[model samples]
Target: MVDTLQLILPGFLLPYLDRFMQFGQELFGGAWQDILTVVWTVIKVMLIIAPLLLGVAYTTFAERKVIGWMQVRIGPNRVGPWGLIQPLADGLKLLLKEVTIPSGADKFVFLIAPVFAFTPAVLAWAVIPFSDFLVLANVNASLLFIMAVTSISVYGIILAGWSSNSKYAFLGSMRSAAQMISYEVAMGLSLVVVLMISNSLNVVDIVQAQGQGRFADMGLNFLSWNWLPLLPMFVVYLVSIFAECGRAPFDLPEGESEIVGYHVEYAGMSFAVFQLAEYSAMILGTALISLLFLGGWSSPFGFLPDSAFWLFFKMFALLVVFFWARATFPRYRYDQVMRLGWKVFIPVCLVWLLIVGCWMMSPWNIWK
Candidate 1:
């Protein structure tokens, strides 16, 4: 991760980033380095966060528009040109709206639940590799960090449901928690094969590991990525992520036509926060898919330049898949969801893990 203020900005623009450091040293004496370190860290964090917020906002817009096109209907055309400003308009409305607390709700937990949900969505990005250059923390155990952080968001749903004191909300949350946990088992196992193959826990290392072999040298690098070698696990991971996000056919949590969602009692910006968490999770999930399964920031064809553009392109493509799945599939029954996770997805992942393990040890090991 580029940690310092000087490191994050282009060198040409701030050829004298060190001058600020020098000036700080002069002004604050021995404590100047510490002060500048804090300032630089804050700036770096903001650079990641500000764009993420905008991306999350626009993701919602893209979802609506894409789904609309799939269903042959126009979406979000009222705010700004072609509804480009719809997300901002929605945010402003939510900001000005009142946050209402239910009669028996626990005020503290109720108010904090949204934060619990939102924090993990943003925190996971700290270790995400955007391209060859951009990343925040660059933790060696980034894959584990992501799993640990993302797993916390479910608690927010549970808390929201319990705090609301509504039977429908509570039931919805329980179902969601069960569904999310079940799918996570499959998701984790699929990634086990990835780590086993890469022999590293760092997500970037996993991507770099893909950027090798004969296909890469032949300018057919897409053939060298993990997805081709680990096809079954790739499919498992994709489906597992869909369920993890509570999206599409897996979106029984938000089965508003039937069971009320966990955030049923939330209103105004409080409600908006939950929405933010959901979309952010979608973006995060798509990003991880791009990095882990597809090559992160690398061109599919070796002839093309590797850049952040490919990462964004892959992320956008995955988002289209999300919308496509939503448009194409009807909601799975709660029982069916459980069955798919436990009986289907889990077994598939487990069997693939064994196959991958054996394949890795064989003389014919492609990864070697």
Candidate 2:
């Protein structure tokens, strides 16, 4: 069993099963440097993945706890002290449960759909700037890369519905596809405003752009951020992010009382994966909103030191607003969602883009 486990395990786990073996190889027989380099890369990957996983877990806890407070009730105090361990308990429960597929379901696609849905949310984090120097990939076209990667997840939703062999699931997937596509246009257009102001597709550059101007010089960094000059686009982007993440006020895809959801046929861990994807996407959205409009790791006042702490503080503030919105607003009706995206947001973004373009050519262009 031990031998079998070692053979089947991933390379990272293999080191744990027999650490000395990896280093005892002839290729690196006595070279400590080579062995440490390989191990360091693994550590770097974990440095990113670990916090993200924890963030997703706690995000679930925060949602329930915050909503509980808003509704005048206590939430999830059963599993551990103050429900601090609730996410872990939920994970164990999901892991222990059996996942079932409908007899008529396409087993292969049905099994893969959750993975397809989940991967992009994780992948997009590769380009996110946690601080001035802390990012996995500092690509020049990070914005474009994020836009492309995120757009692929809709296919997973489409597959989920198609493979389920259930009309309700199919309907849910169709709604999801349409909803995502509509809001994505608005999302993209709002981002265009950021790019125009920053004059770069790099996320780090976007944050850097917000750090310029007189307000920054006087130590009131918040006033210099893109949010002030581009308030309309910021508003449109925030609303579009809510829709993109399938949160309340835009959660038409998984209208639980109506279509049940695209993953309605999913059970146990399969369903859990969908939830993970959703929450991760929410965090991703918050991260993007922080980087683009809220100034990434730049402190509200320049008194704070440059560190990942400020980045996460800003990220947390935005995340709290996400929960607050869920508590405050009722979900929009499907027709209303479509109308707001197409009629209102897109047009507003387009007009704003033209306005920004003209301003860039005018004598008052601050970006100059």
- TM-score, prediction 1: 0.94
In angstroms, how far off is 83's CA in candidate 2? 1.2
lDDT of 1: 0.90
Error of 1 at 339 (Å): 0.6
Candidate 1: residue 353 Cα off by (Å) = 0.7
Cα lDDT tens digits, model 2, 1-368, are: 24555787998887675665554564566685577667766776788889899999999999999889989999889987999999999999999999999979999999899888888899998888888777878999999999999999888889999999999999889988898999999999999989988999999999998999999999999999999999999999999989988998787766678646688899999989988989999999888888899888888898877677777888788888999998998888888989999999999999999999999999999996
Off by over 4 Å in 1: 1-22
Clashes of each: 0, 0
| lDDT (C-alpha, whole model) for all candidates | 0.90, 0.88
Model 2: which residue pairs collide?
none
Question: Per-residue CA lDDT of candidate 1, range 262-361, in tens?
Answer: 8889999999999899889999999999999898988999889999899999999999999899989989899999998899988988898899889988
